[model samples]
Target: MNLKDLLEEEKRVVINPLQDENPPLLVVITEGSTTLARALIYRILIDETFGPNQSIHFILYDSLNFLAFLESTAIEITACAPNLLEGISYSADSSIAFKDADVVFSIGRARGYEFTKNERRESFFEEYIHVAKIHGEAIERFSKKDVKIITLGYTAARIILQFAKSIPPENITALSLLTLKITAALIAAKANRHPSEVINLITWGVNGENSLPDYRYAKFRDGKFVEEEIKNDVWLKKNLIKGVRSASGRSWYSRSSAYALADHCKLLWNDTPKGEWTCMAIYSDNSYGVPTGIFFSFPVYCQNRKYKIVQGLDVSENLKKYMKETARIINEESSIALNAHR
Candidate 1:
């Protein structure tokens, strides 16, 4: 064989090693909140949620004030898992942090902004759009072409998808799993079961307030999957939505949100349990009457490290109206965010 062909074969072998062999190094970057990034770092290193054997390199990138915390986290990780802590780094430079990154968590408000509910919606988008643009540009220029960017907030994801140049829409997703966790946990409480036992609970439409907690396909397991009685329960139809809508306003939002973000990342890299699905705010393709180009939450199944939106489910008339309203808000939010980019 030619020398070039032999070298190409070697590269392929290194990139896609055999099943028993060590996989390629996974480089993960966290962009905004140091507190959230610190929590995720602990979960990954101490809990080993991504698998005890998987090698990971982490870069915590944020404002200059967070540099000290990032360094301390690196030390703690080194002490905890010397072998698994391949390397931990801190960066204030987006380009440096994003270089060769395989996965990124964009999980905070803009560094200088502390927004309140009383603020104008348009103003909120205008502020956060800068965060999206910065991360998007860095990802496009420095990160791997197919890097997975899991943003925390719907507005951030929408802004990135709308105006971020040269970044693939499929590569970006807003994590709606927090709402999923809240919904499942609440239903599990009513059913007197553990939250993990609640399966296929879909968080539809948007991420936070006004999101639809769909229980039609949800099931619970004792020893086997069974229809969740809570689905037909009056509390399920009424109180559940109120509970989910107020979860983000809770005092524990930062830490719990971090956990949810970590869990979503774990599911993205590993196979989700069979016969179940997860929800994420992914860019729409006109599915279920959601507008063609917005990031709306939908049920999805992950296989082979890719997610396919769950299809062929029944949508009730009431659900359709909710989706239509969500589409309108998403478009309005997108336009406001995009106008800031201009």
Candidate 2:
């Protein structure tokens, strides 16, 4: 019925169905401004059938606009699922938010309609990077050691790389599943099939403009090879990346992106399909000749809350060159973030 009640509930232990022993409540700390945080929380609540090793506990953290965020989010949740109020709470304190957290989701920041590209980038680094560092340090110092950090938003991929020293690279992942989902939908549209009918669509590179779609392994879900109409290499080469980038820029993107991110998290919480994999941005270890120590999008196989980068599928010389270029751009962005932090 209240935030206090939810906070109280957070201290209760629950028996894990997969394990005989009792575990502390599943603590999810989400950091962002109003819109993204709202979408993420609502999507997660509606999709309660999946997530983490234990029961879900949500802590919404909005430092700059906690008053408005707290009011609006509470109203939204009450309208959506009043009964679930016992599982959600709001926090303005980073320590309280991150304490004992199992998963950390860092998302959007406030942006103005008139901000220039360079201005937005500057603001993003100033706000998001600082917030990410706070979450990183808090998670490292207070939360579970093996906690997973999932980030989404415009430059979500670049933000987490700033946490290199605070969180293990493997524990931090940036969700670019939206890119893969869009790619699948675009390919499906070519054949007049629904997006879900496409399988194994992968992305290589960073999350933003530099991200590349790799359809070489994509196929129809019903065990049929993708028709040349659906996989039209020439058409894809011309339009796929541009279309995806444009889609991500549209006003309604956050809602769809949030939905995809929630589903992707579910896959991480449970498992991807027996033979299928998903795409995500994780710290690169030179997979496919990407340089080490930068976050890049790649095909990842997820199970039991762990993921392994899918390795050793062939990359064409052209794709390899493009991938390397993407890595370079991300690495440069990472360096800029580092410098800005300094």
Candidate 3:
């Protein structure tokens, strides 16, 4: 479906169960790096979903850098700063904020960087696992009574897998089992309380077929949890790689390449024919049309507010290899991040 159609579907699902007394409130917690983009997107979505006068509150937690960005943008949204700490303190604060919340959007953890490689890696893992615990605790607390949460990032999965691998075989099995159980529990809680809420656990930067677990969560129905496989489109795959690599890299080259590529792709798309798909390559000689099952984005018409993926024109072998390689690098990085955190 097209962007409009997907949004319309979301609106239908969200608004159907509403009563005149309590209007739904969207609470968003975003990381510093993507806060600007997220804020822009949130503004568009909120305007579309609840109109201009509706109440929308944005909470920026553990994000001083993002606060500056938001201030510069001048988007009128309420903001909050939550105290972050190791162990149980973080979870307590999250639970208090989540109480009486209709929909909660959480963007994973944020921490300042260290200079050395060892320090950086250690810091990253420590922050990630702690954030996972906070996330799990929050879900366990609020989801029990029917509050819906859409957590961004595979923080829980990363933590569970890491903890499982580091300990003994018995601990591994126990932790792994607990991870699966918690996932099912959250899904069940959301579905049981608010049948219409879309409770998704998504991780950015993972691409290709291997990234399915990061973006797609299990669906709860009939008192059971079933895995739902969500395929990423070409645009999402490309942009996610660029975003992750740039954000993680130490040098300006990686970051600049990401921004340049995105701008170039956008320009290319504008020049291409309407309803046609095109994938651009920096290493290859030309752009190519995307194949079926190969996620891609194309200009498409949204009827009744639904967007659909459109196919692109055909290209050469070299371009295809480049695209595949780019996706491979992204998936590899994601795996590395997961393993390092574990």
Candidate 4:
């Protein structure tokens, strides 16, 4: 065999090793509010709720210290685990951290609306594109190392709320509300942005079909909640900025709520079904026909220790038009995120 081919063959052992020989967990979180102790505790609780099992080694990657922080962090996780165990293990050793690890929690911070909520908060547009770029890089790392089999986490909703607040409420329709509901958790905690007193948003997936999703959203506006189509392209184009959310400028998002959403999503990643679904916003590729690649929010499902986009459902022309608009946003951001370093 050629030297290059021989080297490539050696790398195969590290890719998707057998379950029995791999680490059971790896959660990647930044400490804007989340900490090592808090992160570990969340894992224990999620395992209990969603079957992370008591017999798995969980790895917490401290983005602050990277892997260098593993030794100290593992001790902390270990101290908290015995009294906390149904049957799980937490470790710092690099060798076992990624072995058999079926879950990867890639979470980071956002540019909060606390800085300024009402105006045309378009500056954050590029900030979130940067986050998208980071996640794109992350997907490549996970795919190569196979550290996670069931990756989990939720997207920041600050940007979505900023845009929603910009438009005329009357021009807003069920479609905009659906977008809002999918991202409401992030907005609910932000300053000056709570699920509207006049308009509470609601969403659900059709049996877990998020791609071409069989889903619907309703707004509690005008004294009641109802689902209706929005046929205004000009309005949609103006208020909706494609690929424009996720930032970490200033604090406003509820700390406790962010913790809750992150943990709940971990449970969802394990396929523990909740009412309607666990809300998550992530990048996408060729599901709703928004293009080949770019991130967008949709209900997703994980089963039998693996995940698949909830797919093959019909989308209305109006919603499809909005979806394409989001696609355009994502496509532009993809370029910015990928090329920012260059």
lDDT of each candidate versus the true structure: 0.69, 0.66, 0.32, 0.36
Task: lDDT winner between 3 and 4, please give it.
Answer: 4
TM-score of every model versus the real structure: 0.85, 0.83, 0.35, 0.48
Q: What tens-digit string does per-residue lDDT give for candidate 1 at 1-342?
A: 554443222110012122434553555546433566667767765656567787666776765556555566656555665355566666666667778887878865622111234543655545567767777777778888778888876667766665455678878877778888888888888778889888888988765567778887787755433343654566777788888877743535776777877788777778688887899888898888887777888998887667889899999999999989877777766666667667
Instruction: Return the top candidate by TM-score.
Output: 1
- Model 3, 1-342: lDDT tens digits are 554433222110011232234343444333423543344333333333333333333333323334345343323232211111000101113444344444333445432111133543666655755665554445455433333333323333333333323321111000011122223344444334342232222221222222211213324323233333223354234643344334433222322222322222223323333322222211111224322221121222222212222234343475456546544453343355556534
* Tens-digit lDDT track of model 4 for 1-342: 554443222111112222343333444333212463345355445445334342333444323234334444544554554422323232222223333334434333332222222222464644554443343343333323433322111122222212223322111111111233333433333322344422323222110112222214423334332223334443223322221132221134334334444454444446634223333344444677755433355544545533345566557787777677655644554444345444
Extract clashing residue pairs from model 2.
none
Error of 3 at 193 (Å): 49
Candidate scoring better on lDDT of 2 and 4: 2
lDDT string, candidate 2, 269-335, tens digits: 7888988999877878888999887777789999878889898799999998998777766666566
How many residue pairs collide in each prediction? Answer: 0, 0, 12, 21
Evaluate residue 24 in candidate 4 and report its C-alpha lDDT on the 0 to 100 scale: 39
Off by over 4 Å in 1: 1-26, 31-33, 110-118, 121-125, 162-164, 222-228, 249-252
Name the Cα RMSD for model 2: 5.0
Q: Which candidate is the best by lDDT?
A: 1
